[model samples]
Structure formats: structure tokens, C-alpha cells
Target: MEQMQIDPENLISIDFENGPYSKTIRTFRPDVYTEDGTYYALLGPDKATGILGSGAGPDEALLDWDKQLAVFISQKHSPDDPVAEFVFDTLGTSKKDVG
Candidate 1:
């Protein structure tokens, strides 16, 4: 199972037509993989609070994932928490950076 490890900022949006409307969707970090030539994009854990998309390739999987993300958000569901905080109570050398 190969994983995507690029910076999240490089992700792009995919445009598609829905009925008589046009839409664009962009997704954040999603677990991407392929099984028997089918590509899948998954966010979070389960269907209740997560989104899953599949396609013939990586980009297509991401595009589908983005579309699903939009739908989930429209229903007032969040796939992942966006808030974060870290208390710096002491001065120390850090070997890694967050965000």
C-alpha cells in the first residue's frame, strides 16, 4: 500500500458538471491506495463521519474524494478536526515542525 507524502498545499481542485450546475472540489490529506487496479481515497474512519471515493487513478480518486467532502460538509458533518493547540511551557529544541 503506497501512500502520498507530499506537502498538503500542493493539492488541486477538480471541476465537474452536476445536472445543470458546475462545481469544483478540493480535498486535504486523504489516505490514497490501489487494490486490483482500482484507486481509492479515504478520509477519517467510518461512513458516519468519514468520506470514501474510488476511481481508476489517483487524481480521479482525489476528485471523487473532494466531491464527497463537499457533500459531507453541506450536511453539517466534518471529516476531521481543524483546531489544534500546543502549550509551550518550556524552551527546548524541536526536531520537527507542525503544519
Candidate 2:
């Protein structure tokens, strides 16, 4: 297996529109946005698989993202994959105040 490198210092923050957010998915809260009447989960950078999941409502969209995140982790994608890294980074940062 090819080794993947980790560049923690070089890691960058992902941008999401200041829209609705929810803590129902995983431990972290992913920003939710709507486009063309469909809600989407803003997972990471726009250029690379920006919107990971989409659905009719925020709850469904978040559910899809949670399932996608689990699949991504189970697949064991190379750490060099930005999409994977972005998903990890997004999930790692949780909203401390959320209950």
C-alpha cells in the first residue's frame, strides 16, 4: 500500500456559507445550505467535491453526509486525498456549545 503523508501545519480551513447548521449528524456540525430547493451539506472546498450530500430537507441531507462520512472512513482512502482530508477535518471540528 502506498503511504500517505500528513501535513498538519499546511492544513487549511474550509469555507461554508453562513447558513443553517445542525448537530444531529455526527459529533460535529456541518453547515447546511439550499440550492434549487434542495438542501446540501457543505463539506469542504468547492473545487473538490464541495457538496458531499443533498436532500429534500436539512435532516435528510445531514443523514446522507453522516453515511457518506462513514463510507469514506471505511474505504480507507489515501490521506493524500483532499476530499477525504476535508471530510476528516470537517468532522473533527465540532461545535463545543452544541448540546
Candidate 3:
């Protein structure tokens, strides 16, 4: 598995993995929102290239969501490099709370 971190100031760090060599790509801008003093991370893969937002503080829920996404992609698409597009369409369109 590969890993990557995106440091975009206010946004939470996005750690992602594609395979053994492909690191999680970071976006320049992240979409962020606060709810009940908790921040949530949102990634608009279609609109933005990388992270859309990060939940406030340490968001286990969001992290889990991301992990699930990675797992799903790995299991469903395996060695595909462009799995992000499929993930974005499948998960992003559903607008389901990953966390």
C-alpha cells in the first residue's frame, strides 16, 4: 500500500493510498465544514482534484470513511490507477456520510 499527506494550512491532513507506488494525491484547496464543533472532511473529486474538506479536530469518522473508500477501491478495482474517478462517481454522487 502507498500513502500520501496533503498540507493545505487550515484543512486536515489527507492520507491516502492507491497501491504500492501511487501515493494519495493532494488537492491545493480543501472543502471544510464545522458541525457541532466537529469538522468534517469532504472531497469533491469531480470539482476538485484532491481534498474537499476536513473535519475539525481528529475525526475518526472521516478517517474511517476514507479508509473504507480506499479498501473498496482496492477490492473493487485492484490495480487500476484511475480508481479515483470511479470512487468519486460511486461514493461522491451518493453524498453518503462516509464517517
Candidate 4:
């Protein structure tokens, strides 16, 4: 897998189904805005291949690098914003098809 740092503004579009999927996962740190905005960070692989969902923080989702993609399908949480909803939806479908 490849890895690179990107400018947040330059990350306007993310096509996870493409070759960049492996390099498209990372932890997100959001900035405060009058209205909520969605941020996408790439998650890298460590050991496992499952998705992890946690509501332990305020309106935030974290996907572990080592977890299986299937683990994310079982998570239940309302996306705080549209971008997040899109990410979850795409991830869910991808995981299902791959499984």
C-alpha cells in the first residue's frame, strides 16, 4: 500500500473503489465551523481487515487500521454530516461485495 500526506482542501473527492483505497484511510481532526462539515481521512492496514465503529466521542467516527471491513457494517450510528453518511454508505457496500 502507498501513503502520502494531502492538503485537506485538495481532498474534495475520494473514490474508495479505485486503487487509492489502501492509501485513503487516516485519522481525522476536524475544525470548528458555524455549520458542520465532513472530513475524510485515510485508514491504513496494520493486521486485521474489519471496520470498527465507536461513538465514544462527540459526533465522531473512528475506523481502526487493523479491523476487518465487515466490522464496520454492524456499526449503528447516525452520520453527523452528509460526507460521513456517504463514506459509511460506500464503505458498507464495498465491504459487503468483497465479503
Candidate 5:
């Protein structure tokens, strides 16, 4: 298994054609790996509140991660929450340390 430690700030949005319409998906930088043939996409850090997704393949696991993260985003919370801050401000494409 291989793992990559990313800055998360470099996350990019992908444009894909869905049938007749074009869609833009802000891709999460999922750490993809395989274990015993099952694939997994681990998002964020490895802690009690970390996000992890598992599936038969890498793409499936990434999809699962996106879905779970979407739900988490839809929930209400305070701006001071670390996880939420990281996900929406740090990990997201928003430029934080700008001039």
C-alpha cells in the first residue's frame, strides 16, 4: 500500500461532461490504497473524527468519501470547529494566506 501526504490546499476542481450537461466537481484529495483487494480512500487525518471510505475499487471509495463529506457540509456548526474549518477553508480552494 502507498500513501501520500498532501498539502490539501492544492486541491483542484474537475470539469466533466455528464450526458448532455457539464458539471464541476471540486475533488477531494483522497489518499487511495488497497488492502486485501478492497480499496479505501482516507480523507483528512487519522483521528477520532477522521473520514474514511472503503469500497471494491479506488473510484468507488472516492465517491463514497465525497458523499459523506457532502452530508457533513450540509450539517450546521460553528466556524470555530477545526474539522469544519479545515474542510471548508483550508482544504477547500479558498485562498487563505493571500497578499
Candidate 6:
């Protein structure tokens, strides 16, 4: 079996904008090697509490992470609120999809 690895050099911070809100996201870079050739983007200390996204490549992983963030933000408001509706429309995913 192959082992998964992560490189400290891959750590990154990104400026994300959704609607009128702008925020920065810090990332724990995906494993350098994986059994399924998937890259996972992670935030927070562990999967249980962290936001996570996976894809075939790093960019896709990051985009998924952004969508996850949008879902997180939308949860703070009523579904019909403009901010909630805007993020759902822009990011296009639900909490289940992100987790």
C-alpha cells in the first residue's frame, strides 16, 4: 500500500469573495500522494470539525472548498435572505454536498 503525504510548502492562504463579502481562507494542502489520486482541501484541525473538499487536482479541490465556505456562510441566515440566496446561487451546493 502507498502512503499519503503532505508538504508544508503547499500551505496557502486565499482571498475569497462572494457577493459583497470578502474573506481569507487558510488551507492545509492536500496529501501529496493518495490511493485514489484525489486531492483534498482542508481547513481547521481535523475532518470532524474542518471544512473539506476533494477533487482530482488541487485547483478543483480549492474551488470545492470555496463552495463549502459559501454553504457555511449561508447557514447563518434564513434561506430567503439575500445573502443566503446569493451564496447558494453562486456556490451552488448544500451542507451535505460539502461534508
Q: What does candidate 2's lDDT look like per residue over 1-99, in tens digits? A: 112232344322323235343443544455566666777665555514443666787767777876766665556555466656655555573232111
lDDT of each prediction vs. the true structure?
A: 0.47, 0.52, 0.40, 0.33, 0.54, 0.48
Residue pairs clashing in model 6 are none
Stronger candidate by lDDT (3 vs 4)? 3
- Estimate the TM-score of every prediction: 0.47, 0.53, 0.31, 0.23, 0.55, 0.44
Give the per-residue lDDT of model 6 (tens digit) for 1-99. Answer: 112234555543333333222242332232322225676776544444455666786667776766876566645545444433434454564634322
- List the candidates ranked by TM-score, beginning with the highest: 5, 2, 1, 6, 3, 4
lDDT of 6: 0.48
Candidate 1 RMSD to the real structure: 12.0
Candidate 4 residues 1-99, lDDT tens each?
A: 212344555443433344222332432222211113443333322112223323223223223321333344346534442333444554454423322
Q: How close is candidate 3 to the true structure, as a TM-score?
A: 0.31
lDDT of 3 by residue, 1-99 (tens): 121242355444434433222223232112344455666555444313333334345444355435544654444332333435445454453323221
Off by over 4 Å in 2: 1-26, 47-51, 86-99
Model 4 residue 68 lDDT score: 31
Candidate number with the higher TM-score (1 or 2): 2
lDDT of 1 by residue, 1-99 (tens): 123343354333333232222232221456666666777776554423456777887677877876775565444322233211111111131313212
The true-versus-predicted C-alpha distance at residue 3 of model 2, in Å, is: 25
Angstrom error at residue 49, model 2 = 2.8
Candidates in order: C-alpha RMSD to true structure? 12.0, 11.3, 11.1, 12.7, 8.4, 11.0
Best by TM-score: 5
Top model by lDDT, which number?
5
Q: What would you estimate as the lDDT of candidate 3?
A: 0.40
Model 5 per-residue lDDT at 39: 68
